[model samples]
Target: MTVIGWIQAIVFFLLVLALTKPIGSYMFRVFDGQKTWLSPLLRPVERLIYRIGGVREDEEMTWYAYAFAMLAFSVVSFAYLYVLLRTQKWLPFNPQHFDNMTPDLAFNTAISFTTNTNWQFYSGENALSYLSQMAGLAWHNFVSAGVGIAIAVAVVRGVARTSVKTLGNFWVDLTRCCLYVLLPISIVVGLYFVAAGMPQNLHAYQDAVSIEGFKQTLTGGPMASQEVIKELGTNGGGFVNANSASPNENPTALTNLVELVLIFLLGAGLTYTYGKMVKDTRQGWAIFTAMAILFFAGFMLAYWAEAQGNPLVHAMGVAGGNMEGKECRFGISASALFATVTTDTSCGAVNSWHDSFMPLGGLVPLVNMQLGEIVFGGVGSGLYGMIVFVVLTVFIAGLMVGRTPEYLGKKIERREVQFAILAALVTPVLCLVPTAVAAIIPPGLATLNNGGPHGFSEILYAFTSTNANNGSAFGGLGPNLFYNIVTGTNMMFGRFAVAIPALALAGALAGKTSVPEGPGTFTTHSGIFVALLIGVIVIVGALTFLPADSLGPIVEHLLLLQGNTY
Candidate 1:
């Protein structure tokens, strides 16, 4: 709302724009199997990993093979994390001696992390020991993100390579993603976080006496390492209950900006990576431009709505922005920016509670997720998700022009369009069906912490978050058996259902030869296409979720204007 806030937001986007090329070019080399500066150091480790796993690095996989490898890897990751959570009390790093997670919570937590959802059903500091934090959760933060990037690279190969039956090997892409990309960047960012005064230790909770003579237990753990990747990888699970809002995790304002950059870093970079792979930098910029527009629009709406404050409070002659659920250090602008940024990607880290935002402000984050989180999206997920829309846009434009649709010389046909539509429809099915069932069922209703539309918003937000693979919550919904089981299932479906079909689309595209572009061919990198892409994304979200959104945040906003509170 303030000029300083506007300046900060502008500067943040500029920096991200600045970073897209360098980081993205490096990633292109990594995934394309070219040598980089890290090659000397990481090459041996990479080879050792393949040797131990008995993987053939020289081999490539068909689309089905790649999909199967991804699924098998996820299965192992889930089993490892689930067992680790259920047995962590007896594990080595139990400095706090926290009890083991129950089977249901463990099931949910494991699925949550492996799918890169990071949705927490319990407080991290209280429910997790040091070992669980590192081995169980942080491990997922690294690998799950790697998996997303790997899948995206596979999709790129499909688009870039013509008449090729093979995409890159899954193991090689996954390995290189971690070694050359995630690990090195994470080390640098993690040290900056530790310097910012966030905790990085194995010490147990300290017992302290307050000045008021009340006893308090100060929480501490291996937070700095987790904090960096939590943002960098767009896996936003916190090391504590309060998440980034916790001083021990986020610390200073400088750290806040740093974390924001980290959350957006790879996602923005991947757009350029996409361009580099497709042999068209303009193609990447077109997608990035659309994402930036959506992001700024959402931020402005949220900031303005929050700046307007509550009309009821204004009627009582108290006038300032809505600071109800925001930290004073962050103020309205930073809080609003954070909400939009985190939701813009699938990163769920928060500096302020979304649940306490004005109804319209709250609606923005919900809609971002419902739009398939493709507004710059999760690390690898965002670029691939936008590519889905790009396909749809090209198809729509083809219909308008009465010609076969072509993107980057590869014709977009019925098979490719079917796969894209299948992937696009997956999240809506996963989100809406479960949400409706929960609304009518007893156990689902049992999780409500508020009455009326606000309560309905919480339910809708939960399913949307899971279905989008976004982990942030509306905060009021209590954890229950039904939520644990259902949301976990939603998380898995959200991640893979779309991902597998995307890979299939990639394979289908990769097998075809590129056709020559003629005078009638539509340019996907043009301004008209960018506008069409954005319109398709917004319209699809609006038409699909308008009724549900009207019942929740829209109704709530109207009620608040009439000086009513739910």
Candidate 2:
């Protein structure tokens, strides 16, 4: 990576780590109902929010019940958002005279956003009105993220409890996730953004009369409020179409720094939270470190690839290499590193276009998506993905040692491994199957804005973007009804398919007693195990994508970079 890219990434990592511990610690208190300075302040509001939302504080549900509640909640959210997007023209604050989104487009968006996928088939500036943007899309950002975190807390409860019938109250977990963790962080970050000059108004869209006489129209909303959780929740959708890459939206360098930090804050903090929840902080740190190692490795590779520049450019005596799809001002180093980090983490905000990236540069993102997005993944989701790797690693280790596989205090039985296998395999099935089907279909082929081998990459990216629920796109697929319907179905499976099994496994683990941390207790937080964990994750990814990647990015690069036209 360039010095600047490394510097930016390192700075963001340190800052996020620093902030995550404190906030995540406080969140521990908030959810546990432990006394804290803000307990008096936030507790009343928390209680009131529960009452208003009709939350039953005393009620807790089993794993199945909690999963049901989550699905039901998402279903309701999808209905609300779809209706809003379809009827937005008549709602209000639509100064652009924008019409309703198409039924299929609205269906795609409703699913994309509510699942924390944030996948975009349609342009935000053209398709959505301010009312729908704020009330529907932005609101869902908070709720979807809340769902992820709630599931996380519920899973933690399963780990903590000793064969309890109930996991935790779904309503309570959701409330704390939203009110205590997401709400507070988002507000502070949102206010900081407003101070940094991002728009924060319910005002109608404005027509800006620029000094250079360029007629530029502006979109404004309760943008700051939405932006905080959008990053903190790992929900990468932006209030405006440009997402975080837009100058006005992410105005200053400091704002960029903060946004980067926000992307990882919870993900890093959740590590510590895991340790605390399981009464084994080291385990959390080990998993967290493993994720960190992978992230930095990607950051470095992305930097090197961009620095190599395009051989195609070099052949033409172009001054710069690897300039394709990158902002001239952001430069190769900054753009490449940012894309890698965001896509790896399920924080899909992009500073550069992915479609125009050089083949290897593009390959980094594709591999990240294909890897189940385990590198610092979504707030709750990334941690879960890595844990699956941890299980697989333990299983492999157990076979060698002639002992049963175990993690933390729980024995890793066939049932848990079965679920882990499901979690591990779910994303690939969603991505590869849809990609294969799309590349053959007339509509999917028609969706390609760019043709040839790279065109295949666009279709692959759409399924990748949707299945992974990482919103950033290659910016080439037309993604009409056919693409949307197929991709949306995959997203539902990709998200909940992996998650439900995770909760089920957590309960299964909870039923088992924590065996003493004997000499054999695998130190998941430390050196050898961490390395092994990463190796296993990489191998899994490589095995899954080798054939398909050869068809798309690898071939595209060979043809394009070698100066041969198909």
Candidate 3:
């Protein structure tokens, strides 16, 4: 709305754009088994890991083998975290003396972090010990994100190589990703955060009297370290309940800017990495262009809606933008931008509450997730998710032009198309179906804190967030057993159902020999393709979720115009 706000948004975006190629190129080298600057230091550590685990770094895997390894690792991770959560009372670093989680809550929390969803049914400071926060949740954050990057690398390899039965070794890709990329960046960022006033310690909570004479318990633990990877890994599990909104987690404007940059950095850079692996950097830019277009459009709409504030508040003689649920330090523009960026990817760490936004403003975040979060989505998930739409876009283009669809030289045949459609369909089915069930059921409605359309939006947003593997919430819903079990199920299916099919598509593509481009072949890296890709992504999302959205935010917006409150 204001010039300064616009400048902030522009500068943030330019920073991301400037760093895309450097990060992308580095990631490419790291995954391609080429030496990097860090190899001298981390190479020994990386080799030691493989040796201790008895993993054969040189051995490649078929797509099925890769998926199996991923699934097996996730299962072990889920069980390990589940046990940790259920037994945190006995674990080390229990300064707060938190008790163990109940069975269902443990099940939900385990699956949530394991799937990289990080949905919290309970507040962190109240429920979890420091050991669970670090060893259980933060550990999952690193590995889960690494898994996503590995899967994306596999999919890219499928496109880059010709006549190969294998993509790459999942273990190697994951190990290198964590060792070379995530760990180094996280360390540097963690240190910067600590210097910027975020806490990193093992001290007990401090009890203090506020200026208003109220006693307050100040939560403290190993926050800066978890906070670094939380955004950097696109894992949004907060060490504290207030999340990034808390000064302990995200203290200043500089820290906020860093968090925003970290959220989009990997997702955006992966487009370049994709192009590099595919031997065409322009292809990456085209994908980046489409993502940027969607991201900017969403941010503009959110910022505008938040700036307009509430008509009800305007009639009440208030003259400024909606700041009800926003931090005064960041104001409307930054809050809206954070909401848009966090949902734009799967990084759901919010500096403001989406539940308190204008209906249309809240709608922006909802629609972003429902669009499959491919607008510079989660770290590894974004690239593969966009590739899903890319496959569909090329298929539709081929249908229109009366030619076979080909992408990166391989034909997008029935198998690939089917797999793409399967991946694409996962979101709607998981989101909408669970939403419908929750809307009518007593157990679902028992936790309702708002009435009518806004209430409906709460339920809709929960499922949408979970299915998108996004962890932010509407903050009104009191998640119980029914909600916990259902959302956890959706998160698992959302993460794997789409992933398996995507890997299968990559495998199918890898087996095919590259076809020479002909007169009828579609050029995928052009402006036309970018436009078409955007159209397909928007249209598909609109057709699938528009009705559900109408029943939620759209209807609520109309009612608000008539001076009605939910």
- Candidate 1 all-Cα RMSD: 1.0
Model 3 lowest lDDT segment of ten: 323-332
Clashing pairs in 3: none
lDDT of 1 by residue, 1-566 (tens): 78998988899889899998999999988888999998999999999999999999999999999999999999999999999999898899888899999999999999999999999999998899999998889989999999999999999899999999999999999999888888898898899888889888898889999999999999888899999889988999988877988889888878888889899899998989999999999999999999999999999999999998988888999999999878877789988999999999999988888998999999989999999888778988988898888999899989987988988899999999999999999988898889888998999999788788989899999999988989999988988999999999999999999999999999999999999888888888888888999999999889899999999999998888777765
Worst 10 contiguous positions by lDDT, candidate 2: 320-329
For residues 245-363, could you state the per-residue lDDT of candidate 2 as single tens digits? 77756776677777777777787888778778887778877887888887877777777777788777688777665777665556776777678777877878887788878777888
Tens-place lDDT per residue, model 3, 348-454, is 99999999999999999999999999998998998999999999999999999888889988999999999999999999999999999989999999998889999
Q: Which regions of candidate 3 are displaced past 4 Å?
A: 210-212
Q: Candidate 3: lDDT of 145?
A: 95
What CA root-mean-square deviation does each model show from the true structure? 1.0, 1.9, 0.9
For candidate 2, list the clashing residue pairs, or say none. 286-525, 310-322
The TM-score, computed over Cα atoms with residue i paired to residue i, of candidate 1 is: 0.99
lDDT score for residue 290 of model 3: 95
Model 3 Cα shift for residue 109 (angstroms): 0.6
Residue 460 shift from truth in candidate 3, angstroms? 0.4
